[model samples]
Target: MPESCRSRELPASLLTNPEMVRACRARDFARVFRLVKVYAGIYPSMIARRCELTPSRVGEVMSGRRQLQHMDVIERIADGLRIPGHMLGLARRTWETPLALATDGRTTPQSVASDPVAPASLPGAEVDSILTLTSRTDPSPSMLQALRSSIEDYWRRDDQHGGEALRPAVLGQLRYVVGLLKENRPAAIRHGLYGVAAELARLTGWTYFDALQYNQARAYFTEALQLSKEIDDRQFMANVLACMSLQATYQEKPADALALVNAAQDEARAAPGTTPRVLSMLSLREAFAHASLGNRYATHASIGEAHRHFDQIQRGDTDPAWVTYFDEPKLIVDTGIAHGRLGEAATAEPLIAEALRRENSTNQRGRAFHAFWLARTQLGLGKLDQACQTATDALEPAASVASERVAGHLREFYDELAPHREEPVATAFESRLRVALPMRVSGSPRP
Candidate 1:
């Protein structure tokens, strides 16, 4: 086949999507065909031609009038769609041969999944750009900027949905960026590359953290800190420390969390690039630590300090790109979350509800996270019916959000409702939970 025809592969984002993966796993080729068209732009005629089926047959499958059951036909579909064999519960495809497992032939779905920086996952330009960066000693400014923008794009997708699907692409990008560091480049280019590498590592850590993979998250976070130090980027180091502190809090190590935050604050103080948003973010981390430890007075104090820093924000203040998400809605939500952590239901409930209303509509993960928190707070107030109602409302969005952290929150709410599981409201919510978040609800381990 011509390279163009052979290079035809599904988009990494689509294949890694939880819904698409589930649909494929269940051999729901009808849904798979629909999602492929939506996400990969492979229309029915194209799918028919590629998969060796009549367009009418493709239409039938997509319309649920037919199913692809024959092993031979299934293999054809797998090879045509470039879907991993494992996803469809089949042996590895013939195209994914041992030689094809090489770094050069990253066309294999496993490679596209584990390390996604290939023609399959990236655009021609991006593939060319990364190859240039890795294969040569010096890379162009434009290429560097393109890579930096891709990092920004990753964060945007992660915020709206969740980081689970983005992990492969990000880790691949991280590896490529880190590889660039070994090559000799101009001082400015090298410095910029370090920044990209640091941020990518941080993002990798965050993705692992979202999935509750603490050890992996910490390793990447620590690497991010070291990479920041390579460029003497103290501000980035501080940010990494803050991220570590947040993860520690989630790990139930509040004392460790507080110490990390203090170290982060010290780094921020030393770095002249620190902005109010950065300070506010660090202070919020401090608040989370105090709250987790049930230090009510200290939690309130740190949150107040966070607010003070937040109030100093001004337009065009030149805050780091990473801290841009620390806007009003975030601060408000964190305050409520801290209150909820301390079991202050009355104060937490209204604040979290209002914050949810003000949250960015595209942030599905945020919506699910806050809704779970609100449900927990309501449960604490003995409003079992209201709690179950809130959770029921959240179930749909939770299905779309692949955050294990959010799933853990859902599990927490379920465990909290255990005592009243026989209650009608709780029973109804339980049924909904089974449908929406079955795997997480069952206490299954994160992959």
Candidate 2:
């Protein structure tokens, strides 16, 4: 068969699969390409040169030519585009399943636990729903406000119920909101929506990181940081920096994490009182960075500083628009988790348990994290039964949310129990852990 004709001979299954067709018909291919181009800025031409493809060829594939069916060719394009493997469907066939199942893949009940970056896979149904919503031109002001209000409600509810109970719902809402943002592209909406995009991107990175999808997570984080910067929101930028620091710590680069945290601290200091909540968050980041670096004294100092900032927040403190979500209890819970990471099980246990006790009054997502850390502390102390129970307890909340950071902690806890796989407590814990973790595409191990 002639090469050009051979492309035509390729099975429809290869080029016209539902996803491929959707990508083409919905113009997602072009959008994704454009996003990449915009993200690459001056480097798009440079990237094309290195890939031995003309800039026009790059445009052609992105513009949805029906003949681009070769997997190798798609991969090369993705590489040149700097698209994450998972997003490009190059990681595994996980996207074939529901988002929940994809999220729980290899870590199911029977399999040995593995780390996979488990970002909420954009389900076909969800994508269609988003498309339907976005297809409308000039969405009504009330409708746009309604969408924004709905997103705000998710954040508020997540804060109130704890992140766990509201995670899946929140993720669904976020995906919808992102679609709306893409469709509308209104400057006024973009001002606020940029922060939302950064948050979503951060969450996506965390999920991917937990699923051991480092490259994808990294890409998401990079995008998040850039978005945050574009908005010129210092607090959000600091949060993104803190997130990057956490990623560095998990990747076992404590120095890098510390550096990022320090940079965040500098940013936070420069803009004190501009966003007290984010500033408090930066303090927590400092604590975590110190903990990761094994600087016990510095960790304690940072935690104290965080606590002081928390104390300063009066009933009427003027918080930035983006940071209206945090409060004292949330700060305590976050600090507790950091202490746990530092191996201060004695200090961490009471604080975590307290956080869990009050979690019912706050966000389901935060509660899930508290539960995971409680389990980690228990595991550290060799309280296998308690650890198993706490770990199992964590799932109820975890299953409700879409944060990869929570999953990453669970994976670490699972690894901790692996050495004692013969013990009954460990066995039970392992079983539950598998259900929570599932196998990921990259097969990377947890820190």
Candidate 3:
């Protein structure tokens, strides 16, 4: 091997470097190329040859004139440069988890059987890639259990701080789980692996959705549906469809959203494991679609149906891990959101306020989101001072979260308050926005 491309193995120190870590996490290959030159003596030419990219294209990426997005290209880069797959949101590379020896420095059969994964591959809050952990090697029940725990932790963190930083890690885990699905397994293990992949895909879709990247969101949601369908997990399929419907709702496609919810309610209900919480969520989504379309009566009917389902909840009923977040507080919040969307601010105001009081304050994004809705509800009822105050209170929580969706809601409320811009309350809110959400709030009104 030429010295410039010398064996492709990056120094372990370089891999653990903070700058390189951030660049890899963000998939900022331009910076990665620069860092490689500084640390590993690999120039752009050698990179092009090793990664199978033309010199010109490599220069373009290194110069930040282009970005690499395709998964296949990413995989190639991971293999060629010897970057750990998890670093680039790909599956773990073959060389990463070599089954070389046991803790005692001997290749014991029992050790390989018991410890198929390196400690680095353990699933945690970071959702690290674990190809050697849950793949064809062992696929133990504990491995799957740990992944589920990691996913649940992700959900908690996402609710609290928003998911912008979580995207890469989640995708890495998702890729690893998808790789696990390729090997033949027992029926139960296959089913379980598919479910985990679907959940991860759904989560990736949500992070994209929260960032307002609807196209990327829809693609992941579709992938989630496909994975769920592969296992005939109708309930999970319904969940993924509902996620797509929510994206459509946000995109202002009420009809499309309605069609998705209708399919979920009609077909997914037949799944043996379907829970009342699932039905309640589907009904709420239907209400959102109807409310968005200004179908007031239909919206009310859907909300009523949602409540009917919510009341069916029993302590012993088996609910999927993902859907457990749709508890009473969230249900109330969604119903209030539906009413607010339908322009029934008076009805929404108290409901939103009560739900907020009941909601977990640790969930910063949720607090900020519901606060925006509550402000809108108050504004609709002609309570200008109250609305502004509510919006002002939301800024702290919103600042803690990194969600474009929350920022959009704040901007939306500001836009609606434009007519009353001259009022002292609106002006006060605008000043606060300029300070708290400097990027979201222009110093002046939108042109």
| Clash count for each candidate, listed in order shown | 0, 31, 0
lDDT of each residue in 216-284, candidate 1, tens digit only: 789889989999999888888999999999999989999999999999999998998689999998998
**lDDT-better candidate, 1 vs 3:** 3
Model 2 lDDT tens row, 1-447: 422222111233433355544453222655544543443332344444534445555555556542233445555554443333444445433213346554786755333222223334323544544644564546455665665566566556544443433433434444445555664577876766766667766665555554556776687678778877877766666777887887788788888899998888777777646555666777887888889889999999988888877777777877765466466566777788788878889888888887677655345566777887888898888788898898888776776655666667777777887777799877775666556655521355442
User: lDDT tens digits, residues 202-269, model 3?
Assistant: 99999989999997788789889899999888988888888888889999999999999888787677
Predicted model with the maximum lDDT = 3
- The C-alpha TM-scores of every prediction are 0.70, 0.61, 0.73
Highest TM-score model number: 3
At residue 413, give the lDDT of candidate 1: 85
On the 0 to 100 scale, the lDDT of residue 42 in model 2 is 22
Ranking by TM-score: 3, 1, 2
- lDDT of model 3 at position 362: 93
